[model samples]
Target: MSEEVIQYTVAPAPPEPPRVPVRYAGFWIRFWAYVTDLIIVGAINGIILLPFIPNGGREFTIGFWTLTGVISTIVLYLYFLLMTKFSSQTLGKMIFGIKVIRKDGNLPSWSDLVFREIVGRFLHRVLVVTNLLYIVVGFAERKKGIHDMIADTRVIHTNK
Candidate 1:
């Protein structure tokens, strides 16, 4: 006696949708965002330092650093660090509809934010000469500043 065998076939999976391309923010937009951020930071520092400035705090110096200068630096670092850590963008970036993202397409970690905001940005601001480093953002193909490159990050538009 001969036995009959049946074969079952599975259907093919559907194709995935096409991916949209990412758009990197250019220098001009980034510059405007930075300017807006500076205004906000200045407002914050002014409010916080008001009481202390009455005692010559603005001119007070600790070695080469003025009292207000030090405080301002700390405030700046905290603003960038905390903003990027929690939301991956500052108020300026959000207003401009741009955001910082890891080059590998992952969310940045605390260490990455710290490096980008504190260490890298500090280097740029530590001396008058180094501030020119920001100009590189305009020349870089990825529209990354030194700090962004240091942290392996990219600033991209959300179009929102």
Candidate 2:
């Protein structure tokens, strides 16, 4: 009897690039998430101001509008600051299963949160052109907005 020998060759597996975890939230989802947050915060502000608003004012004054704007800005800033520092989620983000974190997957410090949520975010909101530019960049540049670049942070889906 003659024995036959067979040789098999196996190809090496391709190496994977380092797994950088990115959340990759699309434009519409992010937009809706922000809208949800705005509604929640706006409702809170309205509740706080219900007593002060005149029942039948002829019209809103410039001063009243200005005051309301200032108060709303402060409330938004505080909301982001607290959520980013403590739990990495605003009420909407919490409900939507998203979170903010450092690019390196660490809990952001108070200063980081403040700088990111307050300074960067405020600037983005104030400059309409820049905000529009950021939306373009977010679609073009791996789902990161200008504020995220400035703060070296990212938004990711949270399991909880």
Candidate 3:
């Protein structure tokens, strides 16, 4: 009869520790990423346009260069938009260990990626002074650039 009385006690699982605060990529890291991307784009541009130069970078007419500029701009925008859309990281971003994400901690959808890479980034370059969005990056709690803010995106370290 003594073996007939068995009691069961259940222990609750321990609470999960709070998640570590997310860290935003800093200005200099982002800057270097941009510079690296520029180098890549510049090299590609030079290769594609060199044949059109005809005299080793010294004999292009205004019309030729104007067309070249348009082509280069299109190429640049496509490069940024496609890369960001498919991978959320361009070559430079991959090398630099950063990525673009929506503010809600999710990957961006195609439209969002397009707006960010095109209207935000491409236009930012065309309108150079908008590059000063870095000022906001330096001051904002999330370190977001104007492009990032406009697209409701954030750049974060991936440690990859």
Candidate 4:
């Protein structure tokens, strides 16, 4: 009987690309970005609501207010969803030269944009205390907000 010997060889892992340092956006920068977005959205909402707003105070019923609120919300959501999904930046972000990217270093997908822009943002707005989540931008190495964390994303500078 002849005995056969088996040999095994392990290949070395591929060398990773040189690491480029990521420049994180700070709290102040992010705050301004948010403000810019608010102004843009508010302006659009104002224009849309203008026609519907009654001429005098008599029509300011609860139903009118509720309907206005819902319209504003839908417009805001659609704005964020479509803009972020396509460009990874809203007008505010574009102006600020910042953009959202997946934490894993991939470009954000539609679902990621949806979660970050709609779900996470809605929760952040509703929970007033969560507004403090912006503090994380000051301290976190990645300068990620609660919404960014929830959506596994990071806001990054485009110039760099």
Per-residue CA lDDT of model 3 for 49-150, tens digit only, reads 776655545554466457678767887888888888889898999999999999887889888877788888765775678667666787887998878887
Score residue 149 of candidate 2 by CA lDDT: 76
List ranges where model 4 is wrong by over 4 Å: 1-19, 57-65
- Per-residue CA lDDT of model 2 for 1-160, tens digit only, reads 9999999999999997677656655566567677888898899899876666666865345664655667777888887788778898788777777778887778887777877888888888877776775575356555767777778777777762
Ranking the candidates on lDDT from highest down gives 1, 4, 3, 2
The candidate scoring highest on lDDT is 1
Candidate 4 residues 8-127, lDDT tens each? 999999999987777777788788988999899999999998876777654444654666788888999998888888888889889999888898777899888878888888887777
User: What TM-score goes with each of the models?
Assistant: 0.84, 0.73, 0.76, 0.80
Off by over 4 Å in 2: 1-22, 55-65
Which lDDT values do the candidates have, in the order given?
0.89, 0.75, 0.82, 0.83
lDDT of 1: 0.89
Quote model 2's TM-score.
0.73
Error of 4 at 94 (Å): 1.0
Q: Write the per-residue lDDT of candidate 1 for residues 7-45, one digit (tens) a residue.
A: 999988988766668999989899999899999999999
Rate residue 71 of model 2 by lDDT: 70
